[model samples]
Target: MSAEVSGVRIGVEERRARLRARQLAAVDDVAEVVEGLVALHATDPATVFLSVAARLCRPSGAIAAVEEALYGSGSGPGSGPALVRMMAMRRTMFVVSRESAPDVFAAAGRDIAARERTKLLEHLARGGGWDAAWLAEVEAEVEAALDRHGESGGARLSALVPRLREQVVVGRGKPYETTQNVASRVIRVMAAEYRIERRRPAGSWTSGQFRWARAEPLPERPVGPAREAVVRAWLRAYGPGTEADLKWWTGWTLTEVRKALKAVGAETVRLDDGAGHILPGHILPGDTEPAEPPPPGPVLLPGLDPTPMGWQDRDWFLPRSHRAELFDGTGNVGPTVWWGGEVIGGWAQRADGSVVWRQLTDRGAEAAGAVDRAAAELVGLLGGVRITPRFRTPLERELSA
Candidate 1:
């Protein structure tokens, strides 16, 4: 066993400041923020666009820019997307830079794909007349259908693949059991494998409805090296994270987390909360102050923004007392108000497309004023498109209602 390194410290305030410089600081490129923040949480659909807007110096064109990166036809025709939406760590959806998608998939997405396929197979087994062979046949047919007819909505694809329209009963013995068509699940599996991707919105960018198309194959990578690469990327943005933080964020086993940390040369450090670890040189032995410390931000981050979801242990940026109001029961975050890099409150979009906010804890008049400006800026950024977080928290729901 290797020896450990300790006696080093990164306090809450420093961590907050680091966060501002690393992620909260404004940038011009959409892809830059995506990679810099590791990846943007995309389950909510709107989260990716909002997260990008939050980081841009001028955000008026954020939605168009993001859409182009994801579905752009390139400089000419038939060129691929610059970013990829994948099932990532913790079985969640995220948008990652195209170059990083392979490692992201190898380290996190592949296992999730395997689990989803297995679960679907098990459900089919319970229903009978459906097995792995049947599932594979349907998958191939769906792929061919998408190719033959170009991209298609789920219902349209289902109509094209007659076999896919059949329903399966899930949770047969449970009170909340329901039937679901196989089209979506099969498409989900293919998406997880990078065999296909969502091509375009059936409605607005905020709409979950999407057309499906065959996706470019992800670059192949070794799992071990990829895990190390992913951990390194995480640490570059969210180092000093505890083992639990890495493990929980990745949905990897504790053993995998430990092995990857060792491979990445992570060193133990003391956080304000407890013992944590950071990549070597993450905090220099005697690192000097940045030429300029980040301002007390009052940045408004959307719910499920990558920074808030980057780690399982959030004490450095999120206070324990605000946990209940800020997150849904299952741990999805709500739109947050931040100042000095710490999450200070929540915000919501009202029925009239207005953005309203309230502080969970006071950071004073100056911070509040700054947050007010940020809110007004968000209102202009939104431009009357009402966005409801897919997962609503108590605070957001109350504010919106």
Candidate 2:
């Protein structure tokens, strides 16, 4: 059917091209790359660096550049760090541009903080018989400890506030039931509330353990306007997406999703799944006027990379047949191998510090060679530093073994 009748059909090729172009595949500037993606998934600390490396035109010095952009160099914006890592959207951590942090905080972080606080309180009451007043006192104590120490680790703060050392039973009667301290949960809530911020790690970029500091005041904007701004930015980066996609990505209600879209005046377009919304004035190119596709150089994206997790409907870029192999039971994606914007397979590092991949589809000898070259480059990048994913998929498990 014609695009006019079908509503601007965005075919696979166009989608692939857009992925390469918009994702900054050939760009080397770390700050700009992170800004373009809006947020780089920071759940796995290494994912931020690995994701930047994958998109750079040249991977050399990529890690240093990412660190500089993340921690800053006592300058501002271009010369210094313009991004800040914060927990937002589905309670996942992301490295968002400093300029965008306020909006993201208002749009999703505040609500998540509220839910998390309520949940933590319930857990405390049920698991430890702690009441709201006790929780409040503990939070105040923890905040005070952070203030006194000025950028301390969770363990340190827990040490300062003895109540933080108290344990609570989680998943009682379940096989995975375990006792956990209340320290991390309280700190996480404070971070989401913008009462504190997570600074650099105690060790390398791959370290998950972070030091916490009192957060600087962000420019205050109303939640409504902030939500609208966040939605607009999301559409610019991952548009032509369904309302469901926005809701899932932002952790907002259906009503909120509709409201944000309306506020942004998002335009609708046809997708293989259903009607999708794009930013106003965005027109998908037709087959007759197709854009040139990016060179089919293979790329190894770290697990939970934003490109793989950007949308709710991923069939346009990731094939259905490969889903089970590439993603874990929790729907978390592992390290993915991409060629021409489609997920062809997954990659993992071996015991010998070499990267190995299993191609689920045969994309000809040329593509295979390119993938091999990419794997070699990744191995060199690692320099014998064995990296393990926090969430391991079956394929990754098999390959690493």
Candidate 3:
């Protein structure tokens, strides 16, 4: 065991203050919020909007700004599609800042894309006597169709290229066996390869049906440098985390994680859980200002908010007792309630379009009142437009019922 460093402790309160200061909480700008956290979980379409809404001090302006950042064009210099939705880290979809997209693609997405492509090819081969030439021809046809028609939905593209309509068996003979449409797989491959992008939804913001557009070529970056850059950014925002946390978050091999940390010159520190790493100069002094911690108040974070999903080791902010209730079977989190930077419970909107919550811990009456007020504010923000989590947890399901 490494010797513990006295007076270098980062308690829960200190972490909470960092959350507010770093724009994880009480933030106002959508781009800045996304940039600060590096990315927002976007597996659920609603998660992107709700995540941004929860952080904005003024929730009224959040929707328009977030929409612009996500879908708007360059009206002026340095302002074109401020953020992009991409498949990265852990093979999950994330809304990443445009400035960070290239690095993310190079660092994490490229490998996953390769694996997906290989897997798809194998499945295709199993279905018939498909070869690499067939895949190339299909890809060319799909690209040509998109080029001629501009942005299109998967169904439209499938109509244009009849081959895309073919089905492939996945997990055959297994309990969870299912068939997958070749159109969806091709589209996924195109997106992962950075050859295409998902534009605005075909329906409302809550809809998952996205139109596809040709992607602008990403600026070239070497994999090593890109991995180091992303790792450094993550450490700065959610650091003092264990190697396991870094590996889990990035989906990188242990060797890759170690190399990236060494490349970034991360310093080792003793976390309550175990040894963790942080960027140099990130340590706070023993007698820093703001003697008392700031009141984090109550925040209703969306499902898969980066703050909660940021680390594999979540004991610092998430209580162990509430894990099963807050997270789904696949380990995806639901909409959560935060008080002073710690997740105290979970919340949900009833069918009547009212937001309700269940506090798992004995938070004081003052905290409870604040949480209630926050929930009411969130309900007002929605204006009776009830939102649902893509992956619902037990507590959220119970409360919503």
- For residues 1-401, could you state the per-residue lDDT of candidate 1 as single tens digits? 14354667677667777788888888988978887888889898999999999998888899999899888865676466888899989889989888899999999999889998898888788854599889889889988998899989989998999988898887787998888877777888888888889877899989889888988887889999999989888887776577777888899998998888778777666566523434322322233353244677778889999888877878767778889999999999999988887888999999998899989889899999998898998999898899999999999999999
Clashes of each: 0, 0, 0
Give the TM-score (vs. native) of candidate 2. Answer: 0.88
Instruction: Name the lDDT of candidate 2.
Output: 0.80
Off by over 4 Å in 2: 1-7, 74-81, 169-179, 273-293
What lDDT does the true structure give each of the candidates? 0.83, 0.80, 0.80
Residue 401 lDDT in candidate 1: 93
Give candidate 1 regions above 4 Å deviation: 74-79, 171-178, 274-292
Q: Estimate each model's TM-score.
A: 0.93, 0.88, 0.90
Task: Assess candidate 3 and give its TM-score to the true structure.
Answer: 0.90
Better of 1 and 2 by lDDT: 1
Q: How do the candidates rank by TM-score, highest first?
A: 1, 3, 2
Model 2 pairs whose backbones collide: none
Per-residue lDDT tens digits for candidate 3, residues 62-102, read: 87788888988646776567788889999999999888999
